[model samples]
Target: MTLDELRATAAARHDTCAQIKKMIVSRLDLPIEPAWITDDQPLFGRGLELDSLDVLELYVAIEAEFGVALYDSDMSVFGSVSRLADHVNPALAERAPTGSA
Candidate 1:
């Protein structure tokens, strides 16, 4: 692809990541800004300190906000904001960065 197309793809992924971060923060009622969460930051346990309850909330919120249902998916889907972005926005899945999943 051309440089412009590559940049546009990156921009789309970045935007999706940002939206996931905001959804996590808002849906989970976390005491932090959405921008504070990095695209690669972990979403559970040691990373964002989320738990099973948080994941349930996210499943519902994701469906409502992004029109993607992740309830039947595995826990790996919550590996990070970038990973979740791939699921919520399948267009990004093809161009997802290595190890983002």
Candidate 2:
């Protein structure tokens, strides 16, 4: 890919990360800014300390916001924001209209 293509891909990933963080905070009612979520920080346990119910809520929110249907086998990607983005970006790309950057 050209440098421009690489830049575009990076920008799209960044946007998706921000959107996911916002959805997490809003759907979970967390008192945190989207920017406060680091890409590699865990979303559960000692990190954000979310529980199973929170994960369920987040799943619902993700489906509603991104039109992606995640399955039980896909749960491993929820470990961190970056991992979530990696799982989600392809689905988002599929949903994006042709020629949109």
Candidate 2 lDDT over 1-101, as tens digits, reads 89998788778878888989999988988898989998767988888888989988887888889877675735566878867876667754454442322
So what's the TM-score on candidate 1?
0.91
Best by TM-score: 1
Q: What is the model-wide C-alpha lDDT for candidate 2?
A: 0.78
Question: How much is 62 displaced in model 2, in angstroms?
Answer: 0.8
lDDT, candidate 1, 11-31, per-residue tens: 999999999998888888889
Q: Model 2, residue 12: displacement in angstroms?
A: 1.1
